[model samples]
Target: MRLFLTFCAFFALVAVVFAWEKEDHEIFDLVSSIQASEGKDVNFYSWLEVSPSATTAEIAKAPFVQAYRKKSMQLHPDKNPHDKKIHERFARLGVVSTILRNKESRERYDFFYRNGVPVWRGTGYYYSRFRPGLGTAIVFLIIVTSGFQYAAQHVNSRRDLARIEDIVRQARQVAWGPRMVPVEGQRKVKVNLGGGPESEAPERWISMVVDANNVYFLHPDGDMELLDASTATQPAISSTWFIALVRSSYQSAFGRSNDLKEAEGVSPPQADDDELSGTASEAPGSGTVTPREGQTTSTSTGKRKKATKRR
Candidate 1:
């Protein structure tokens, strides 16, 4: 529960950091358009020909109003129809003028003007400003999801390593006794991984061999496998669930195709063997023929000749 709360709090903080009000987005849109239409160094105050610290009262008065009207007339679409972005600039100008006209909106713009707008205003801001295509969105999702999966893998790998270390330590303690002094020869021992003496559930035991500085798994067949950093599963991009699943699926499909090809290749020889056996069974005989016990070979030949002459 505590961990869940911590994660929620973390996401909340991130959301807050990325959060921008609708009014703030309007200001951002205005700033981006003005810079894009005019020059990079031009700002809202300079574009409107007003002072950054100018009072709202001054902005509401004639001088500011006249300057805005003049700029609006110059950027209006009808006056410059050849300019494809003239209407956008004209609309952007109106938004800018409105922001300066209102005291609250003006203050918001002033703050950003002084400090400069943020370079990155989160994905929502960018998505609204420049709508990404499907391909770009998919690539973005893959990158984000893969990054999260990779981070989760690292967290799990650390946990698994800690558990493995604990098990190795327990095995070493059992083999070397209380002092845990380095033993010269390998000593085999069993470590209880789960279920205590008081628990009714069956205990899980792992047999291990301990030497002077190392612990090894003692297999049932008397083979020893060393336990170290390699014993724990490591974190990797390829090990992330999505990528791993894709790779495994591809391998499975390829393996099945190869198996089908092998089956096809092996069939022809078996079919040929079956055909040979069939032909042999269909044949009259394989050995030399002999006459019946009472008949001679010449008598049979004369009878076949007489029968042919009659035909």
Candidate 2:
């Protein structure tokens, strides 16, 4: 009876020791499981103990396959239920094997291994910067071409504004008897430096205009006085010169720029016209007259009020 009790005590003590070890394993959890895997930087190649550039077929050989199966089972969550990281590692190992075993995926992994990852997408968001295909290239070209066209139109519009402003400056000097004024309440004028579709009116086409005996420029933002014409003078602009300017603008818009030199003889020179009349004359039927460009032909011999009447 005493030997039997001693034997039972020994058996019970062994059971207690085994339970304690199982409890320790449960407490440590994934730590013990992590130790099962080798290497601090166990990439797929190192994990499988294969060449860095091993192909899918090579990796699928009997030896590699056996190693993969054994490792997978050892690190599986079921094998270490109390540990979580080993289960994760086991899952990760499967993914690594898949990537390294496929031709495309393997090439991608190789690239990442060789070169440093991009900082923008460094959080494991592996991606490729693919080249634009034929369709994409065509779309890009279309956008660029449209942008250039709009830019050209914009530039031409600005240039036309400047020239019209010069004419207005000259008009102001002639309208007010070549004198300068700085009064407020300056009104707006409308001038149409016409260059559009063929469907627009001719004489009614507005480019630049005058108000309050002052010459102001007209653009998208309405009338503005960029230069003071009260004292500053400009050469007289003839009907021919104005026509060439408009024609050049129109043709340039249509991708055909007319040479400005061709307009030289087409219009009477400002110097010659001045010598003949010594006063502003309307551009043909413009009806405004003064001592400068595009003035109304109004011979009204009065003070500042009558000046704006010059065509």
User: lDDT: which candidate is best?
Assistant: 1
Measured by C-alpha RMSD in angstroms, how accurate is candidate 2? 32.9
Residue-level lDDT tens digits of model 1 in 39-150: 9889888998999778999889999989998988888888997998787788888878888888888888888988888876776777787898999988889889999988
Off by over 4 Å in 2: 1-42, 53-58, 61-70, 79-89, 99-192, 195-201, 205-311
Please give, for residues 1-311, the per-residue lDDT of candidate 2 as tens digits: 99999999989766654442332232123222333555545455777667886667988898788888887888888888888567578866777677667787676657645773333332112112345788987777866765665566556656666765666665554444456563345444343344456746553333333556555555667645454433333223222334456777877875432455555538774566546564435567785444544343433475343234244
Per-model tally of clashing residue pairs? 0, 27
Candidate 2 — what's its lDDT?
A: 0.56
Candidate with top TM-score is 1
Give the TM-scores of the predictions, in the order they appear.
Answer: 0.69, 0.29
* TM accuracy, model 2: 0.29
**Cα lDDT computed for each candidate against the true fold:** 0.81, 0.56
